[model samples]
Target: MGSSPSTLERHGYTVVRELGQAVLVNSKDGDQCVIKKINLREETGKGSGNTDVCDAVETLLGLSHPHIVKHKTAFADDEYMYIVSEYCSGGDLYQKIKEQSEKREAFSEEQILDWILKICMALKYLHDLNVQHGDLQPKNIFFTEYGMIRLGEFGEFNERARQAGSTKDGALSYISPEILDGKTHDEKSDIWALGCVLYELCMLKSAFSAESTVKLIPKILNGSYPPLPHNISHNLQQLIEETLQTDPGKRPLAGEIIWKPFVLSFLTARSEKSIDELNDNLVKLRALADGLEKVHYGATVGSLTGGVIGAAGGITSIVGLILAPFTLGASLIVTGVGVGVAVAGGATAGISNITNMVNQSTDRKNIRSIILEFQEKMNSVVICLQHITEGMEELKHQISLKNEQQSPSGGTIVKVGTRVSRGLGAVPELVRLLQVANMGKVAAQAARAVRVAEVATGVFSAFFVALDVFFIAMDAKEIHNIRTTKASEADDMKSKLVLQSPEATDSDSGADQEPKSETMKFVKKIRETADELQMSLDELKEIISFIPKLPDIDA
Candidate 1:
């Protein structure tokens, strides 16, 4: 009987009989119905018994497993909880098999197909969702009146059962070796259970039967997977053995297992199959991958074009700046000086950044990213240089508005350097007739480029203030050197003239005495050193101060 007295009057389910704590009932709605009293207070060491059941309810309500019974609805009274589910009229698969085998009744191979494949698919699906059915006895799966198979009784399902039980989650007959040996259970354990189910469906007997759970556990560990009765196909036997493999990691994934050619070959045994042909296909796939690599090589070349475009545009701008003096006169000095300062600043720092990128790049895997970074910076410097050239050209245009067009004395290839002073610092015009290139070592290319780029940016941005201050001080020292050397020379000559005249006999002769010959030579050498030092200091100050001022125009 599936329903009780009050429950039947309300829902129209006919009570048939009672089984222990549950009632057998028939749904008047022309559908099979089974209702069981739920025991929510049964505690397992994992957590609150009520908590596990609540979680299981959440999982079962959303799933539509074929081998596992679908939850229709649940309710509870003050005395007991009620669970409504589909009922199999053919009785439990377990009782039927026991009845058949005990009576020496024959089973069908065709029925085996329907039973085993469906069970395999259901197990695979549950495994994919990380749900394990701890109990996989035939009693849970039943047949309809028309012999349609249905699976039921999800209360002892593995995932929840494992949480409840400290050790085993499934029946002793079908548990995998890993779970028996206390390993963490996973999807492969489901495959092992499916193997047992397949064996039972073929043989109409339990793989390892014992009167008690403890003895049956040992029989399972020793691989007494359900007996393969005579006349079963070799393909099926090999598949079951493979699924029963001890190592879970070695098992084939479900999708891979289901579509093996053996399944198809089992239908048509004479079909040709070659291991060599599979290997050949794999080789061709790798070759096709190589062609994709070839395509990427062509892409990296784009970064090189970026470098060339940068070099050309830089030259054009600097040349245009220098031409402005003739083309614009005094206005060119103001505008040309700005353009000149910009060209020097960008070349010094901008090229250094690219050079670092080119030099530091070592790892080929990251080379593509480095190439991309280089291309972007190259474009920025190119455009900045172009703007500078344009500014020089604009000065020429303005001068042309006041007069006629005038051409520069030389091409971009000609060397140009000049020293000029402004609050923006000494702006030195440096035009390279050719590149002052430093080809970098290729061993650790990316790291070298990154390091160089970082150093260039850090020194110029973070330390520019300190550097500029140092340059200003150096300039003051050289100016003092020139004045100091002149003053010393004038005093030395006066003392030498006094020593050769009547003043030599005086008590204060120390003041009138001529300096030693070496002292006179030292004074002459200091004058020469002051002039040379001044030239070097002025050039350096121009370079340092020019770096910051170059970006004033719309770069």
Candidate 2:
């Protein structure tokens, strides 16, 4: 946007349109993209500047996902840097929504659900990588050809600009209350924005619309909004309500939202396929966790045994060289022991939280509470794993330093350190595997909880075949009871009538036979449905059990 199309052409892109500070461009290969031009010197307020923008762009370039608008490449001239990314032809969701509103139309329930699901999937992906989309709104949601949506306009440039003390514009209505109150935001803030976008889609207006930002802040902080239409389903109403809670802790995570009854009802076949793939990934993760548990246990035992043996052979004599291997081994073992204890504690807390969640799931009010606890515990587990990995690396560095020291025992220490390093080398990889497994486990549990809740709530769809069977059986039982009652009354009447006339007996017999036949068919249906429901419950239990049980590291 800053440079002419001819200037940009020399850099290999034909400018199409200017979007804010970014310009839409077409390459020689006919690839359409949006190029963000950053004037490094102007941004840094210097004659020449560092490569912070360049480094940030490189990080963004590494991110690739279906819902995330892909960053293709980056290059820079002396004064300006250009970052290129995929361009969406259908424009942004905000523009589309504005056009629809102009036509006096609101997005249907199915359309809103589809867009929300796609956005949540992208947010979940980014959150897993610890990247927060600080600015999320309808304008950031770009529609591709065929109406597929991708999240764009992430705050990378804004973030860098802010670091240099520049102001960045954001939509006030879509910002979370926490952010408005001068608090740092995380993934939950994005979820809050999601709630606002969804509300707009349904109502054809903003939830916290105001004449000015000054008025909007008060409404967001107070969590006030126009009530949803009475015709909106209770499930959807509940979801939006919880997401817009003023307290960030009360909001359900992006991962948890996917499993809500309202969201699950609109899941497409492709969504189911993704769930299956996720299931497979979780299974692989559990196996990885199992292997890591074993390694952790082995390392702890090895460290403790080595330390005791080394201490027993005193290091106060010339024979310390003979005991050098034992000493080095003890140092490595001590490191492992420290890591093991931390991991064990974290695992124990996570299990406790999960158990509480499972127990309290029936209480809708308590669902958010349990999720908050679970999220906190999982965060602790991740921190513990990260610490363990860092500690192992530090241990390796220390051993290397020791090996460099000039001493008669240096050779022995080097030899022992090398062996120990090799043994502990896999610790980082194991930690990484567990971290990934934990994420998968969280998503799986959330999905399972949703399915179970659907059955309990009587929302029977094709996806819930077992639940449908159970409901059908209940309906048959009710019909059978009604028919049986009618048949009994007819028998009583027939007894009275037979005393008066023999003709009534013949007619009553046919009616009585029909009721008996109908009752038998209904009974059969009830039995079949009951069996199917049981099978479904059994299958669900198996899926829940697949959530990897972290070893009692505390023990």
Query: Top TM-score: which candidate number?
Result: 2
Runs in model 1 lying further than 4 Å from the true structure: 1-14, 27-31, 42-51, 65-68, 103-106, 155-170, 210-216, 224-230, 264-555
Candidate 2: tens digits of C-alpha lDDT, residues 1-555: 556566678877887777766788888655568887777778677533556677677768988665778789887777777778887777898888889999998777767877787788778778888888878888889975434578877865555433334455447778898888889889889989999988888888889978777887899999999999877766567778878999888787776665432243244233334334434433432332232223222222222222111122111121133222222112211221222222311222121221232122122112122222222222222222222233234343534545455465554444324322322323444334334454444445545544643452242222134323332453344334434544566555434532633223223464344322221333233334334434434444454444333221100
RMSD of each: 39.4, 30.0
The TM-score that candidate 1 achieves is 0.41
lDDT of 1 at 300: 20
Model 1 is weakest, by summed lDDT over 10 consecutive residues, at: 414-423
Runs off by more than 4 Å, candidate 2: 4-7, 46-49, 159-170, 268-555
Task: Report lDDT per candidate.
Answer: 0.43, 0.53
Q: Predicted candidate 1: what Cα RMSD to the true structure? A: 39.4
Task: Give the Å shift of residue 127 in candidate 2.
Answer: 0.6
